[model samples]
Each structure stands twice: as structure tokens, then as C-alpha cells.
Target chain A: MSQLKLNTEGMKPIYVQIAEWLETEILSASIKSDEKIYSQYQLAEMFNINPATAAKGLNILADEKILYKKRGLGMFVSPKAKESIQEKRKNQILKNLVLELVTEAGRLGVDENELISMIKTSNKFVGGRDHERN
Target chain B: MNVIESRGLTKTYGNLKAVNNLSFDIEENKVTGLIGRNGAGKTTLLKLIAGFLHKTSGEIEVFSDNPFNSIKVSSNMIFIDDKMSFPASLHLVDILEAAGNFYDNWDAGLANGLIDYFNLNPRQPHSSLSKGMKSAFNMIIGLSARCPLTIYDEPTTGMDVAVRKDFYRALLKDYLQNPRTIIISSHLLNEVEHVLEDILLLREGQKCMHMPVEELKELAICLKGKAGIIQELATGKEIYHKENIGKDSAYVVVKNDFTEDRLQNVKLSGVEITPVATDELCVFLTSRNKGGIDDVFDRN
Candidate 1:
């Protein structure tokens, strides 16, 4: 029941929150590829949101081919769901975070060279396990 | 079919038009929130649907037929108001038995389960229970009735915050198990907003806004920055509220979302953009000092 957490005060809409949560689940392999993910009803129960909102969230994944629906059954993860989700997140979410970091750094008078070295130093800490897992 | 439909619905009491020329169709199998300030006609509209009050002029259709005193509509709907009265002589058990006979879709098992969950003693009379207890009992009946078009007007009137959360959890659980058209009119927007599929906002007897809750959030945004900078940014934008937070910084809600290009100014101007909750939007939309609709039409 407590597998996924939500912030009611978060700025993102509920549907977007649901979608991102599903992505995290997929990436973490908690929901294996081609396995049955939550039905709208199950999601509605879990999040205490409208089933339609939950459906909208599922639809986002379906639209992106990360999830596929079966007739008379629930949605299933696409075989390449994790890769696709990671690719999309890296392109969009991670990019946004980096942009904000760079912008904040500039505001604080930190130069590009300093920021790059900081990123490099941070990257080395996760060196072997991250690449091996990927 | 639309679960409930109102076309040019007008209900007036003497000089006051409680509901003015309102037209909206509530779709089946969706939870819609009917919200307004006190005396803004939420109860009047629900009462009209529940067959307790007839509209002064115009139409209200429930399940494709006129609802005023119609047995058909009454059979399919249960209107739960917090202070709903039961015969004082009849005990809670008797009322529960009577409720089972009234609604066709009633689930006795769910009724029993909810009774236990809320820790109610069925032997106690309705009049003897405290306000919070009364509300909890009302909720048990409403949830167990399983009516197709169920309406709850301020169902959490006297319940504490913990009990309110439990009620919402039970509501979502039941709703997931059995889909129905549910309408709740409550002042606790922050607690209830997540459960709502759409919001039908009323102000001074007129339908001010009707849209999905997500869209409502997108339609307005809160901006914070230097007083002069915010003032400049607010020009040509629909400003909901503006106030100086300190000597230099100010908080402003404008009718727009800030973009990178939009907030790019915030960076140079030392301004910050932040989240605005729906409750704030609702307050600004309904406040008297805001001049609401009057301001829109007052060109001078």
C-alpha cells in the first residue's frame, strides 16, 4: 500500500505524479517488463484520486509505447519500458534539473569551469556500480 | 446519459436569486465537486436535484427526468447532509434497516463494515449522538447506499482531521469497487480536491468556473519578486491578488503560468515563482473584496 509515495502539496498535477511514479517503478524493476501494472481502479484506490485521472496517467505511458493495453485486461509494461522511460527522463527531467543547477550557479557567480569540475567530482563517486548496473 | 443536467436553472427566494441561470451537465461515473461560499446556492442546487426544492424557473433533470418530488429520481439518489434528521424515537439500527429498504443498490455488508470501522453503536438513537458521530453515521449510510447519483453536502461538518482522512479513504475504496456519479459540496477544498474529477465553482448564485482541477491550476499562477518587478510583470495580466510581503518583495497571483522566458525576468529582477494551491485560487475567485464578476464588466 505504501509502495509509492505522493506529495499532495507538490506543484505537479496528480496525473503527472502518477505517470512519473509508474516510470520509477518500471525503472526500478519492481514492475517487470510485459507484466500487469496497476489498473485504473487499483491506482485510484492507492492514490485516492479519480479513476479518470489515474487513467490519464496510464494513458501517458500507453501513448509513449512504454505501456500497452490488452483487450478485456489491464495495461502491461512494454518490453523496453525502462529504457524508454530513462531515455525520456534523461532528455526532459534530468535536462531541466541541470538547467536549473547551471542557472543557480550562474546566479551565485560560479563559472562553467567550476560547475564542470563539480559535476566530474560528483560523477566519480558513483563510478563502478552505476555503469555496471546500467 | 448525463447523470444530472441543469438548463438555465434559476432558483430565487424573494429578492435573492440563489441559483441564477445555471446550465451544466454532470457526466456519469465521475466525482464532481460543487463548491461555493455560504449562501451561494450549493444546498439549493442539491436540494433541487434531491426533489426537496423545485426551481423557481428553468429545468433540472436527474436520470433524464424531472427530479422534484419524482419517486424514480428519489429511488436512485441519496442526498446526505451532515445534520440529516432521522426520527428521534428510532434507534440507529432501525434507521439502518429503513435505509436498506429505501435504496435499491444498498449493501448491508458494507453498511455493517462501515459501522464497525467508524465504531458506531447501532443501538444508540440519532438525536443522542454527538455532531461528529452523527456525521460519521450519515457517511456510513451514504457509502453503503451505493446510489447511482449520490450527493453529499458538507459530509465532514464536525469530523476531526483524522476522521476526515478515514472518510475520504473509505470513499475512494468504495468508489473504486463500484463506479457511480458522486457529487460532494464541501469547504475543505484542499482535502477533497484530489478526489474530484471536475470542479463546478459557484459565486454569488452564478456558475463562475467549471473545469478539471488540473486545468484550474494551470489557468492561474503565483509570482513573487521585487515589488516593482512584480507590478511590471502583472501589467496586461489578469491579477487575482497582489500584496507586498516585505518592504521590497511582493507576492502576486496572475492568470498565467510562468515560463522560462517569463521567469527569465525573475532571475534578473531577483523574483521567484512558486506554487499556488487551489484553495487560494478558490478564495480569490469568491472573495467579496475581489469584486469578482463586477470587476470584469466595470470598464471605467
Candidate 2:
């Protein structure tokens, strides 16, 4: 959707960035379940990246069972894509992010209870809103 | 399979070896970047593949046949660069029409569309266009030809940044519809890095690194942190670049893939990890007197 702005300067690999970008779109329901996803060719055109590199991104999602191929019809989001994506991100990314926050909080003398309370209170303000800005 | 392959290929001029004993393959349907510093024999290699230059020794093959003045190879390939010449009497459209006679895969509609997109005037003489306009026109021809093997050696020589972006966007768009083997040799690595499937690094005419851009990114990453900690952490890693940032702080480019498991406490403490863009990587790898990048790769 041209919403994904890649950070070429960052340490993150490009394929991983592409996968994460598509994942965010999937999680937001902007790209729905059972819907045909962008082919590697389309992704290559859209992002000005190599088609092979784009295919690798698609492959990453396929490996995670987030996207599945349909023979000649191209890749489609799995029916349980959103759930799997949500669960995976929560366990993998969000957990790591929260852990980092807690580590920083601990370093700053903000104890466990204070950090937990802060998160709980902050959740209310950010409730019903996607944390990632489109 | 490789669309183009060379084994111990050597091209010399007088006493100087323009291209040393080089060996590499150009994989089919992939956009490969052929990059090197000045006088690194990039143009010579392209010419050899194009049948414009004869190799002094070793083997070179295109589509399993020698490309030296072969009609089969010439018909299937398109080569464009800054030095590309056109008949002074021919108009832009006239030249394209003539090109159509040669390249069977030529798409006239695509050429016309590119003409419109690049704002190239068909009525104008090819020689009359400015430096940037000529490059754009050349790019249009290269993209529209849709040959099995297309080589553009510094195609964006005089084109501006916006024009270069347009060229890449157009190339990718067209390439999606019709897959082909494309070799783009450019000094502007930052612009072409993402679009390239693989990179072929050449130094003093020898094949250096022929790696996927993604893997190369992982292999060579810059680490910024305190000098002491940076040095301690860089014990066994291949250091690409090391520089003093300030009085006690330094930045080092280590050939670490920056895997998740590789990220340790020292990283969270101070060391800021960043990716080395293809441009910097090329400079570091090709810069003389610091030992070659190929030599430093202990893993390979």
C-alpha cells in the first residue's frame, strides 16, 4: 500500500523488514485472511527491491504459515493468519520489546510493580488503537 | 544455471593485465551488480561478454556458447553504457525503429511509453540531447529491449537522482512482467543495492565477492561503541573499517552477520549496530593497501 517506509540505514536485514511490513498489514486486517497477497514481482516493483529478495520475504511468511501458496493462483493469507500472527508477535516481538522496557525501567530504579502499573495504565490510553502508525 | 560463466578469464592490454584471471557466473533471471573502483576492468569485462573485446586467455561463455561475434548471443543480449553511440543523422524514434530490426524481443509500445515517461522527444536528433537526456534515452532502450541478457554499465552516469529513481522503478515494473538476466554496473551502490539480487565485487580484475545482497548485509555490519569494548569484542571477527569517533570512543565495521544470538550485553550497553550500505562496503572492500576483502573472509 506504499505505507511501508524501509529503513535502509538500520541493522535489520531488508527481507526481514519486508516480512515485518507485510505482517503489520496482515495484523491490522488491512490485508484480510484468505486474500491473495502481493506477488514477489509486485513487491519488487513497489519497493524497488530485487524480486528474489522479495520472494525471500514471502518465503519467510510461508515458513511461519502466515501465507500459503495456491499453485498457480499465487500466495494467499492463511485462514488463521491473523491469530497466528498475533500470537507469534505477542510471544516473539512484543515480549522482547516489553522485556527491553522492563530492563530499562529496572536500570532507572523503576521497580517491577511501577513498570507493570505504568503498562497497565498506558494500555487504557492506547486501547482499541493500533500501536503501529500507518 | 548461469547465463554467463567465465573460468580463469584474462584480458590484457600491452604489458598491463586489464582483467586478471577472473572466474564467476551470472545467474539467469537475477539482477546482478558488477561493481569495482576505477580502472578495475569493469568495462573491459562487459565488453568481453558483449563480443566487443576478445579475451587474451581462459574461457567465457554466454548461453553455453562463446559470445565473441556470435549472432545467437548478440540477438539475445543488450548492452548499454555512457559511451553508447548512435548515428548522428537518426532521430530518437528512428534509432528505436532500427533497433527493432535487430532485437526480436523489442517491444515498441514499451519504448514509446518509456519515451513519454522520460519525456524524450522522438523528433529530436539523438546527438542533440543533453548528457542526462542521452542517459535516460539509453535507459529507455535498455528496459524496452527486454532481452534475455541486458547489461547496463553505469547507465545513470549523467541522470539526476529523481531520474535514477524513475529508471529503477520503471526497470522493476517492466522486469516483473518480463523476467530477464540484468547486469547493472554502478558506482552508486546505495541507489542500486536494493534492486540487485546479487553483487559481483571485482578488484584489480579478479572475482572478489559474488554474494546475495542480503547475505552481504549480514556479513558486513558496522559496530559503533567505546574503543576499548569495540576492540575487545572484535577479537576474532574480520574488521572492515575501524575509526576513532572521538577521544575514547570508536566505530568499527565488523564482518558479523548480527544474528540474534550474536547480540550480547555489550551491544545493549553502548555499541550501536548499523548496516553498511553497499557503497561503503564497496569502498572498504576495494580500497587498496588494507588487504583484500576476499582474503579476510575466513568463513568462505
Candidate 3:
């Protein structure tokens, strides 16, 4: 997948948006492991961002072992990049949802029991008939 | 080992000291932004480095050799000025051919691709193109030439917003592909601020400030609060600039060592702080009337 379109008007830096896009593509299997990624120049051209900004995003992926470079060749997705990204995404979502639920509960002056019940009800709706089997 | 280095570099044209005692080192493989007001000697500095003009005093070195009429050193550097001239009778194809022979690392494919992308007709005479189109053609050469030390002095003069944006994008893209020392001098301050890694600000033909963008941002703050409280807080400190609207006042300055508790006790209704931008910083620095290097340094 190409780099996600960035909202220049947004307060967040464009590089952060680029990193998020790459992570999403990796988790969704749109960019498979061992697939060749666009060079920094191509990415900069496509996004209209400074190469330094593009390089910073790619460096983040490299740090996560999502992408690796071959000397004189080009950058490619790591062999286990998909699995790694998936695991990371799962953890991130869980952490974010928990934080959101706690914050919402506190704001509404609801206790832990009330929050757990709300979660159970939502899970039932989401799981559908599978809730009965569980 | 300096790609470009100058010591007490001064250039004077009759009564006007176009460049004054400026000294800086431009390291290899890094992009530096040359910025200043219209008569701030940015063009003069570029010309000196490109060896198009002789300096009045001091020294300049490019790749450990003087660039004045030295073909070996000059070939490695390309200066694309706003008033860049070519033979009016020559065709665009001939210009490209000449540039290809001039630079050792010229990429014909990139030049051809850019020519097509910009919709430039190679068969057209050099003088026949519109001013904006001519600027675009110059940009094509700057990008595709692949010079190690490329300097652009207001290379986007007559281009519209869209075309200018395209040029910036192409510049960034090409720089990433081939990392080198590039200096861009332009008056469109805000547009180029994001792409610039470092800024060399000049005023009245003098180097006022040189710092990395992030570092410079950290040093400046825009503070708004009660006029009385702001005066008290700003007392015995350097106030670069200030604005007042009745009871409300705002002060811009380099970040100082002031405690929040002290400011809180001032009983101001509110205090809003934000980072000062490069352009704002330049205006503040150059707005002073003193005509000396010390005055410039003091303001900065």
C-alpha cells in the first residue's frame, strides 16, 4: 500500500502520520513481509514531504524490525514483519480501549462493576450468537 | 575537509557593504538554508562561493580549494540564480546537452523525466518560455544535475503557488535520492521553513544568526498576559519585540530562565506561550536600526 494521505492541516507531524500508515498496512497484510517498499525518494515524491521526514518514518519501521535494508539494493519488509505488527497493534488497541473505558467511567462517576457490565453487554452485541456458545 | 568555508568573508560594492565579515562552515551531505532580507547579501555570498564574483576581503574555500575560476572546484558546484542567463538563441535541448557535459554526475533519465513531468518543450528557444516556465526549466537542471554543492538563489521567482509547491516536492525527493550539500535562498520564508534543517540568517550584509531550526524554535517564546505583569516579567530581560492591546500585551524573546511560580503570582488573567517561527525571528532581529555586527548579534 502507498503511504496514507496526510492531513497537513492537522496538528500532528506528517512523519507520525506516515508511520501510522505503514503500521496499518503491515497489520492488514496489504504490505506483505519481504515485499519491496518504495525508496525514500519515491515516498517523499508521493507525500510531498522532506526526505528527512520520510527517512525518520522509515527509521521507526526499521527500529521495529518491520523493514530492513539491503546494501545497494533497497528497503524490504522484514520476514516476520506482519506477525510483529499484528501483535503490537493488538497490545496497543487493548491498552487504548482500557484507558478510554476507565476515563469514561470516571467522568460519569461509574464504578468498576458498572464499567464491566457495560463491556459485557457490548461484547454480547459484537459476538452475536457466539456469545451463547461461550 | 569543509565543502564550503569562509573566514571574515566580506564583500563590498562601492558604498554598500554587500557582505560583512561573515564566517561559517557548510559541512558535506547536509542541506543548509541561506535566508535574509532582499539586500541581506545572500546572493553575494552564493556568488562568492560559486566564484562568479570576487570577495572584497577575507577568504572562501570550496572542497579545500579556492573556487574563483578554478574549473575543477567550480564543476562540482552549481549556482542557480533567479537571473540565470542562457544564450537566447539556444534551444532547451541544447541547454540540457551543455549541462550534461558540464556535470560529471548528471542523470539524463531524471532530466528527461522532469522535462516530461513539467511539460517543457525541448525544441523551444530559450527566450520563448514564460518567466515561470523558465524558472521551472532551471529547477529541472538543478535537480537532475546532481551537483554535490547546489545553491539556489531565489530560483522560484515567478512561479505560482502550485508550481512552487511542485518544485519544493521535487527538490526534497531528489535530495533524498542523492544526499548532498544544498543551499536554498528564498524570500518565501514559511514555505521553505519545514524543509530546511538549519537556517543562516543575515541582515544588512551581516550574519546575524545561524542555528538548527529545532534549536532556534526552542530558544524563542511568544508570551501573552496582562500588560503590567508582562512588563514586570520582562523587566531586566531582553525583549525582542512587543505588542500591546489595552490591558493585554505579548512579548517575544529567546526563552529565559523564569520560574512559572513567579509568573503565577503576578495575578495575570492568563498566560499563553507559543514557539516563535523563523520568519518572525528574522523580522525581530533585523528590525533594529543599529548598523554594526554587535547590534545584530545583540538582537538575536
Candidate 4:
């Protein structure tokens, strides 16, 4: 029952937003394994999208094995969806952050080693014990 | 995925065939532009897809199912026309309330925000709003409803350039936040050309061309220069449209290879060569008394 809101002012497609929202819900374990998620029609009516558009988002999840259809019933959250979703989301975020850092470094004439040093210095200044060193 | 599939889709109004055996597939997660002249049957085809009109003969599939009277299918699709008429006496807020009830995904916050952005007073009667305001109201519903497949027919008809640009900007912004299959039917081709992933060109109710924007760009080029030089360089080539202004002549459209070396040669020959805009290309393609299709293909 995650309240997935759409920003008509943004440039992303509604389907992608819906997919991201569903992924977030799955990762948070808000939608449990084998839970009967809303059907494409229901989702469409709920979101004011054409059912086909909603189906596209659902299909993306289904393709990733995060959701599965029960045939004549409805789509359900996959048993391993939460774990898979978490792994996928984490990898995606890291990749995006790395890309951003690389791009910024290119712009600012800074190297990866400098970035790594900055991270270490910042961690030290936070005054947290180095658990990695132990 | 093929959200909409049509085969030999034809529509006739007495002697005029608005859509003549049209066939095209609207894919998922892409913005498809429906472009045509005033009587080009763009609206007819859209209405046909929306199940508001029955086709004379042919097949149309929405989500692997016929869209006509299919509650599940139709419920997912929303069609916002240019002339969105609410009751004459109904207040703007009342109309929005009705819209919310009609659309399950209607975002009241988004609607209210849009109303404020447009400076529309909710207490104003629907009949009292200007043409531009009415269009804005319809646009708000189309965007805020978040419908998966939303078809907008001439959404910016009477608006000023500034307002039209605002609508496009808002549309792009909304699109980034929520991706859906949006079909925008408009005569203002130059305005919406960039926003479209693909374009459907209709002429006399027939699909004249259905292709990606990049492909279409590659297919046509504009050549301009001194009349004599341009004519010499364009010899034996298919000219889509040509205009001569005194000593300087410009062909707004032509079919040419447009390769770097070839284009350089044309330029060196004192002819200016550039790619034709989608709008200019459409006008050129649909112009009556133009050469045959083979003539267009022979330019290579």
C-alpha cells in the first residue's frame, strides 16, 4: 500500500516511476512474498494510466523476477523479491554515484585517488572508530 | 510491447475516407506523435483507438484485446480532446471534482497546483473561461490523471507562444517523473517534433509515413543557393518543395544522400544544404500535385 505519486512536472515517464516505486516497496518488504499485487487494470485505474502502461511497469518487475503472475489470478511479489530488489537497487545506486563522481572529477581535473583520499579524510574527521581496520 | 495494433483500419464519412486502411503499432513507453493536416483524420484515428468511433473496416487491438466497449481496456486509456466541454454552469472546482471521480489516479494536489500555476480561479464558471484557459484545464487533467495511454488532440490550439511553450515544458517535466505512452496529435509539428520519439504522418486519412524521427531526418535534406546553381545540383533529384525569392532560391525540402562529401560538394557548388525540419518535411510530403513515391525514393 505504498503511496506512489507521479510528478507530471518531471521528465521521466510514468511507467518508470511506477516501476521504481514498486521496486522500493519490494525492497522495503512492504509488499511481502506471494502477496497479490494489484492487477494491471486495477493499477491503471488507481494511477489513471492506461492498463497497458501499468502492464509495462509490472512486466519490467516480472522480467527481473521481482513479481510473478499466478495465471487467471493476479501478479504477486516473488518469494526472493525483497532480497533481489535490495541487491539490484544498491548496485544501481553505486553505479550511478560512481558515474557522477567520475563525471565531476573529469570536469574539476580531480583523479579517483584524490576522491578516495577525500573520503578517507572525511571518515576520519567524523570520529568513528575504524571497524574495517579491526 | 504493442499497446495498440491496427490492420487496414479505415474510417469513412460519406464520400471522404478519413482514415484509409491505416496500420501502425504504438509501442510501450514511447511518445508517438500523430501529425497531419486539418482534415487528415488524426482525430478520427484517435477516437477510433479510444473506442468513441467504430471503424468502417479493419482490426484494432489494445493490449492484445479489442478496445471497443472493453471496460478493462478502455478504463486504462484516456482521450483528452481540444474541445473539453464541462457543463456551462459548473464551476472549475466542480469539474475537477468530477474528474477525480472519473479517474482513479487523479492527483488532486497536482490539479490544484496546476490551477494555481495557470492562475485559474476555481470559483469561475466553465463557460466564462477563455479558450486558452479551457485548453489549460484539459491539459491539467491529461497530465495529473497519470493515465498510461493518454491521447491529446491539438492540446495547444489557441494559446500564445509563451503558453504553448509552458505546456510543452510541463509535459516534458511530467513525462520524466511518470513515463507513459503519450500520443500527441497536433498540427504544430515544429513545436512537438523534438518531444516525439516517433511520428505518424497522415494524409487524406491515410498513414503517409510511420517512422522514427532520426530515420525521417536521414531521408530528407534541404538544398538552397543561387537559382541556377541549385537547379544544376538538384538536376535529376527529387525536389519535395521549392521556393524562389528573387536571385536567391531556397528549396525547403529535397531527397538527397546528404553524406558529408556529397553535402560538401553541394556547398562548394554554392548551394546551401541542411536537413529539413519535421514540419517542413510534412508539408512537403503532403502537398498535392507532388511527385510520386518512387520519385522521392530515387533521390539516392
The model with the greatest lDDT is: 1
Q: Across residues A22-112, which tens digit of lDDT does each residue of candidate 4 receive?
A: 8887777778899988776566555544455677679889999899988889899989988887798778767666665666676689887
Q: Where does candidate 2 clash, by residue pair? A: none
Poorly placed runs, candidate 1 (over 4 Å)? A128-134, B257-269, B291-300
What is candidate 3's lDDT per residue for B53-146, written digit by digit as tens? Answer: 9889998999888888888678888888758899999999999999999899999999989889889999999899999999999989998899
Model 2 is docked with a DockQ of: 0.74
Instruction: Order the numbered candidates by TM-score, best leading.
Output: 1, 2, 3, 4
Rank all candidate structures by their DockQ, best first, as comma-separated numbers.
2, 1, 3, 4
Q: Count of backbone clashes for each model?
A: 0, 0, 0, 23
Better-scoring candidate (TM-score), 1 or 4: 1
Whole-model lDDT values for every prediction:
0.87, 0.87, 0.79, 0.79
Query: Which 10-residue window of candidate 2 chain B scores lowest in summed lDDT?
Result: B257-266
Instruction: Compute the lDDT of residue B153 as modeled in candidate 2.
Output: 92
Location of the lowest summed lDDT over 10 successive residues in candidate 3 chain B: B260-269
lDDT of 2 at A75: 96
DockQ of each: 0.62, 0.74, 0.21, 0.02
- lDDT at residue A72 of model 1 (Cα atoms): 89
Q: Candidate 4 versus the native: TM-score?
A: 0.65
Top model by TM-score, which number?
1
